[model samples]
Target: MKGLTLDAALARLLIVVLMALTLLPFLSMFSAALAPSGSYPPGLAWPADPQWANFAKAFEVAKMDELLLSSLLIVVGTVPLSVLFATMAGYGLAKFDKGRGRWFYLVFVLGLTLPFEAVITPLYYEIKALGLLNTRFAIILPLIGLYMPFGVYWMRTHFVNTPKELSEAAQIDGASEWKQFWLVHVPLARPAIMSLAILQFLWTWNQFLLPVVLVQDPLQRTMAGALGAFQGQWGTDIPLLCAGALLILAPTIAIFLIFQRQFVAALLQGAVKG
Candidate 1:
């Protein structure tokens, strides 16, 4: 009884500490964003009147609709490419044995550890050389490449979990390789693919440095880039920045919340099977 009581107390204390740490900045930001705009609040007190319209003002000034559309386009293009490439690569790696498999596997795994910063310089030149700079495709193409190794690894793991017998059975039938991949494999991979898509989408949506470095045209840039530009232009207003952040964060947050149950289940299922 004594030990159980102590453990409960510790758990409660840890939770309190964590909640405080997590909520403090947000609470401060909320208060600051609302507290009449001139100075910080007197203490930990929230704003007497939270100016919700600050958000609208931010939207008006920032051309948020355009920013969001740009982000949407990048995400739309990148997600499918990443998934298709990764899935095909992963499936091939898992299913097909060319005997040089170990070398390819090592190289693919090595890609996960390669830092984006290290490749940025070379990537910039490559994009520029291809005459793709200031275009969204420049960012999209690199993202797909960067996503490929991990995507392949993720799908490959899932594919391995799927018994070899499934594919062999399909092959023993008259089904072509493409048909088997599309019909038999793709359906089974829904969970693994969904999990990877959510992860990749969030990463791509929030991507900053790559877009910042590669994109020179403001309208062509993503929401993250636009936010950076927003800061440069109207940073004196904290409320506006917060408001813009809220707008920027809204769609992904809403999507995650809507699919929270599925996301959790998919992650757990993939972990268990893979």
Candidate 2:
């Protein structure tokens, strides 16, 4: 009993330490952002007079309003289409794994092995050829394609673990394939879908490389991608740069905090079932 109690205490301590380690950088950045512009903040030291207005200044300088709109456009273009296709493809693969579906599943599995960096060169050329090199479609289209493998994989995991009896029962009721997917499975797969959407939203929001490579306009790029330009212009102003970075990061943090429960629940379900 004492040994078990000691193990539990140690686990709690470890968790606390990990949390501190994870939070320390953000704390330092937050402190730095509150320091007066152009001054390098001493490591993690609280400023005597915190310049709270730096956030406002950064917002103005970064043109965060436009960036937010552009990011929204890209995310809106990418997430729904990707999720829909992935869910349908996943359902097909999971339901009909006996034949050519296995081949298609293998293709998507192969896609999972591909790294984003490896395809960037070819992708850039392909986008250029399509005359989408400097457009939002450059990011959106590529992201949809890139996300397919993992998205399909994630949805497939959920579909595969679902009771076949539910599908069979729906079939017995004279439901078409479309109705079976829409009415029967989709409603039950809400948690997985929501979790996938959240993950994709975060990924899309933070996308830097594709936006930077494909789009020249800072306003057209994602907030995180445009940080390159923001940093280049404000490199000498440490506090302002940190402030801008924090602003760029704020939405992602806010979203995760709000939907963390759903995310955790989906993850726990996957862990238990998979």
Candidate 3:
């Protein structure tokens, strides 16, 4: 009991330290964002007069309305389709015969090793050939393909670990393969799917490299992707830059907060099973 008590106390202390470490930068950024537009606030020092207008200024200067809409469109286009394809592919890989599925699974696993930087040059040429450069499709199509390996891998792990008995029972009840997948497997895979959606949403929203390279218009790029131009224009304006940075980060933070329970549950579910 004494040892456990000591361990608990140590853990609590470590948590507090970690929390402070994590929050310190955000506190500093918030302070910087509130400082006078031209002035640099040192460390976490609070500005005498908080420049709340900086956020509005940042929004206007960065053209956040356009950026936000573009980001939303890209995410809507990319995440759902990626999830649907990944789920189907994962299920196929998990349930199908080892003879054919293993080779296909290995192909996707190979995809996991192919980093964006490795094929980005050819990808640019390919998009140019398709006349997709400078359009939303350029970013959307590449992202869906880029995200496939991990998405399929994540869903496969969940489906593979799910008990075969459930499928057998469903089959005995006269459920077709399609019915079994949609009715029995999908419901059980909800947590995993939700977690995968969250991750893909974040990745699609924050995607910078592909958007920057593929799309010419800043308005068509992801919010974070547009930040490069925003930064280039307002780089010297520390407060506005900080505000823009915060705005770029806000959606992802909100998403994680809203779905934190589902996310944590999915991750823990996998960990526990493993």
Candidate 4:
């Protein structure tokens, strides 16, 4: 009992230290945002009079309304389609013939190893050739393809771990493969799907490189991607820059907080299976 108590105390202490380390930068940014615009605030120093107008200024100056709308459009375009196709591919790979499925699954796993930097140059030329440059499709199409490897792998894990008896029972009842997938497997995959959607939403929303590279228009790029231009234009306005940064981060933080339980649960489920 004493040993267990001591170990628990140590674990909590470690967690507190880690949390502080993680939150330090955010705290500093928030402090900086509250400082007067055009003033360079020192690190972690709280302003005597918080400049609440800085957020408003950042929003207006950065054209956050447009950025948010563009981000929403991209997320809507990418997440559902990516999730649908990944779910189908994952289901097929999990339940289909062993030999062929294994090979196909290997191809997706190979995709996981291919980094963005490696493919960005070739991807640029291809998108240009297709006349997608500077268009939303430029960002949307590439994101869908980029997300597939992990999306398929994630959903496949869920399907593989699920009991085959459910699928078998549905088939015995005269359900077609499509019906069995939609009715039986999909409902069972609610947690995994929810988690996948959240991950993809965050990824799509926070996506910077692809949007910056593929889409030439700042108005068409994701909020994070547009930040590069925002910084260049208002780089010297420290408080306003910090405010914009916080705005970009707000949605992702809110999403994680809201769905953190499902996210953690899916992670544990996958970890246990592995």
Model 4 TM-score is 0.97
Best by lDDT: 2
The lDDT per prediction is: 0.83, 0.93, 0.91, 0.92
Q: Write the per-residue lDDT of candidate 4 for residues 1-274, one digit (tens) a residue.
A: 3556887989988999999999999999999999988999999988999998999999998999999999999999999999999999999999973998999999999999999899999999999999989999999999899999999999998899889899889989999999999999999898889888988999899999998888878989999999999999989999999999999999889988998898788678768865
- What is the TM-score of each predicted model, taking all chains together? 0.89, 0.97, 0.94, 0.97
Question: Candidate 1 residues 1-274, lDDT tens each?
Answer: 3656887989988999999998797776666666565454554577778887877787888888888889899999899989988898888888764678757977999998998999999999999999999999988999999988778778888888888788889989988999999999999989888988998988888888888899987667788777788888867767767777777777878889988877887678667865
> What are the per-residue Cα lDDT tens digits for candidate 2 across 1-274?
3556887988988999999999999999999999988898998989999999999999999999999999999999999999999999999999988789888898998999999999999999999999998899999999999999998888988999999999899999999999999999999999899988988999999999999999999999999999999999999999999999999999999999999998788678668865
Worst 10 residues of 1 by lDDT: 35-44
The TM-score that candidate 2 achieves is 0.97
Q: Which wins on lDDT, candidate 1 or candidate 3? A: 3
lDDT of 3 by residue, 156-233 (tens): 888999899999999999999999999999999988899889888988998989989998899999999999989889
For model 3, give the 10-residue run with minimal summed lDDT: 265-274
- Give the C-alpha miss distance for residue 82 in model 4, angstroms: 0.3
Model 4 steric clash pairs: none
RMSD vs true structure, all candidates? 2.7, 1.6, 1.9, 1.6
Q: Judged by lDDT against the true structure, how good is candidate 2?
A: 0.93
The parts of candidate 1 lying over 4 Å away from their true place are 1-20, 38-44, 269-274
Pairs of residues at least 3 apart in sequence or in different chains that clash in candidate 2: none
